[model samples]
Target: MSQETASWVRDVLAGRAEPVEPRPAATVMLVREGADPGGLEVYLLRRVSSMPFAPGAHVFPGGSVDRRDIDHEVRWAGPAPAEWARRLGAAEPLARALVCAAVRETFEESGVLLAGASADEVVSDTRGADWEADRTALIDHSLSFAEFLDRRDLVLRSDLLRPWSQWITPLAEVRRYDTRFFAAVLPEGQQTRDVGGEADHVAWMRPAEAIEGWRSGAMAMLPPTVSSLKDLAAYATLPGVMAARRTIVPIQPELREVDGEVRLVVPEGVDYPL
Candidate 1:
């Protein structure tokens, strides 16, 4: 935590500061393999130490939804914006943006595209000079998502995504994000490249193994990551994990004092040692 953030947390816990507005954001957990505990793997990126939020913390690929993502011109497939809006608890436009951001950010950060020529297919290979150009443009915000998709004649594969959870940053933090989490099976033959910029390192980690790293103080994770890993640890396979219905809940943690120590408290029933 930053020094200012630590001070803000103290103040919030002391009831001396007001919470800030949380920005809408999206993130995805990409998994591959089957039912075996050892077989299940998730991609994680360690945000660069220079990042203002979650510096040096291991996280999935995601960011705040770009306003342009709501553009009606974006080539879209799968659920219509109205149905998606109802499902995500947002206006039609924002719901569209959230879904778009989920796919776009995944491609931007990890070099994997959750899009294809049609609803039934996924782009098997994202490696090429042309694809690299679009990726760079997307990162720089030089190209709008709709235009990018239009140029390639690709459709966003919203069906490939499964809603997982929603988490909000604690009031104590200077930067807050209301993030919607989604899960997807890493498309076969579409591998993640380092594509370093915001991240210093990347790896494939099992939920239980990742928790062990945190237990030994070898890696850092935010509360949502910690809790999500625990929830995921119970599942044996992607199909089982995705098929089970969940009542989507909004989890916004807060600062609390316990036993003379001040700590950020995530909601109850989150089983993490951290």
Candidate 2:
């Protein structure tokens, strides 16, 4: 059978002939030192139009958790996985995996590696080809992240990640992600490159400017992403951004039809997911 025919058959078997279901996912926002106090620049990826979900949207790097993420073992920092699970009101295993996936996806989508010892130590030259090969193997299900870490004797560096918000896609959408958002300052000397083929393009832009771009029709963004960017725009520095994160109360907005168009409206004084 032709490749197109095989894809259609697979989709039909997976119930894509009907509607898609909302699944758990995670996104990481990478900030780096810039010229100004609020020089916070976020890494954005424009997903390819051929993807099954959120096709052609400029989004933070993230995706649904694979079963392997749950079983994988690696040294970790930050809040315990169980604690994160409770805060997110999800099962322990799934929550833990979500965090792992967030870190893994960030590295895969961007060339920046958040996991390492002191920022100084990470600057030593490393083999990008080797890392890319491993990433490909992991994505192909031939290697687990746990194995990847073990082979490299690296830690997960959970302390580098901070929970920002949680969001659930509207039920009306055929595809959805129960996504958790995390923030991390880019490690010293680690630069972000657009290497993930899933994204057609990538850029580093301040939150306010990105929102303005969206309004001016210079860019297209999903509602959650827009809302998140607006929230980030209120802060001026990495510390300020982290401080504001502590006060965030995850708000999953209710989707309603306004003027015959779908819109998500959240309660005031609450942080909406991106």
Candidate 3:
């Protein structure tokens, strides 16, 4: 390991350094079919190199949960906030905010809305000029997600989302997030565009392919993204994947120096590559 990294790890382990407080965040694995005939395809965006966090790394569409996302004024359908709280292992308000943030961030970043006018129906298209304006507004925080939904007469579809995993940024990093992960199928007729401030390029890619790129050092993926892709690569059907159950466990990787190499390491049997 570089002498600097080794010293940093030692300081952190010895409690000489305290990790920055992690802010709550959320991300979605938007999946569909295209690449492997037997596997699922996912949406990915490459953050610009200038981004303050994870620059140039390819990530799912998401961001930190906006405070207004907790607004009770939002019209919600599907699983109640209390039930989601039990599943997500969080208080009701945070659970509601997480779900609302998931849907809102997805629309803002990828142009895909997992909401509907009624409980049973999802919007087929989001290509209208007005929709783009709202998307931009959401990104800039000029419009709250609740207001947008109310104005459009849409209901947030919490049922459409499946909680996947939770990961926290390492304390060693100045930028940190307590990010909740969600997976949802790409809605039909709606498409993801290369939108967002830092994402300059976007694509519908297979998890295996993305992993292969990372293996070849042709792409950059954070530890959580890498681990999730490995897990995602195993599933072939949307129904099977979504039908599976998961217990929400928070994983925070630690930085360690091993045999002169500094590496960020997940827990044993965590199935993550450095």
Candidate 4:
């Protein structure tokens, strides 16, 4: 890491600088379906080593919520934002905002837009030029996600996102995310590209294959991503995979170092979905 980047990370770690608080972040696990049934894949991004957080780890496209994600003017579908908030044990208003942030971050990171007609109509012309700029502003606190959406008369397609799993970073980590994982089938005519500036590379791989690669030292994965991939390997089709989302449970693993190797301990007797 560069000296400047290392210094920033050290400040966050030493409490001299506060990394943003652990807020609701969203990750989209895109799966493709096929007749032969063996080609299913999920999108993965290898974050740049210079990143202060999770450098060099292959991870899903995601980031923290921004204040702009809460505009009531933004359109949405599926369960109400209030309901999602209740599920997450957060305030109703903030829950809605986080949902918007998740969708926006996924698009900004992967170049896969999830919003439909209504949301598109507003910024249909400017989306190409302004989307990334707006996203950058939100990340830097210069603008809000919802405000940016409203400026273009767009609405978030919350219906397209299905909650899969929830995980909180161990308290020991200086930077954390109270992340919610969602699954979506790769949309028709839309493809994922390596638009995430923070990522060094991107690829589509089967969950099992990714696990094998990580085991063989060809890939490096953070614990949460590894766990999610393991959970995904159980389903064969998009519909089947999404059906599993109905059983949502929060997983907060206790960090443990056993036999000189770090591991996350899921509580005994409690059935873990992943």
Off by over 4 Å in 2: 1-21, 117-127, 245-250, 254-274
Q: Which 10 successive residues of model 1 have the least lDDT summed?
A: 32-41
Residue 146 in candidate 3 has what lDDT?
89
Tens-digit per-residue lDDT, 62-134, candidate 3: 9998999999999999999999998888999999999999999999889999999999989999998999999
RMSD per candidate (Å) reads 2.1, 5.9, 2.2, 5.2
Q: What is the lDDT of candidate 1?
A: 0.86
The candidate 3 region of ten consecutive residues with least summed lDDT is 1-10
lDDT top scorer: 3
**lDDT tens readout by residue for model 2, 40-137:** 88878888988887778889988888877886475566678888787666789987898889888887788655566432234222338998888777
Q: Count the backbone clashes (under 3 Å) in each candidate.
A: 0, 1, 2, 6
lDDT at position 174, candidate 4: 53
Give TM-scores for every candidate, taking all chains together and pairing residue i with residue i. 0.93, 0.83, 0.93, 0.78
In order, candidate lDDTs are 0.86, 0.73, 0.88, 0.71
lDDT of 4 by residue, 197-232 (tens): 799999888988888888888998877788788888
Show model 3 residue runs off by greater than 4 Å: 1-11, 35-37, 258-261
Q: The CA-based lDDT of model 3 is what? A: 0.88
Q: What is the lDDT of residue 257 in candidate 1?
A: 61
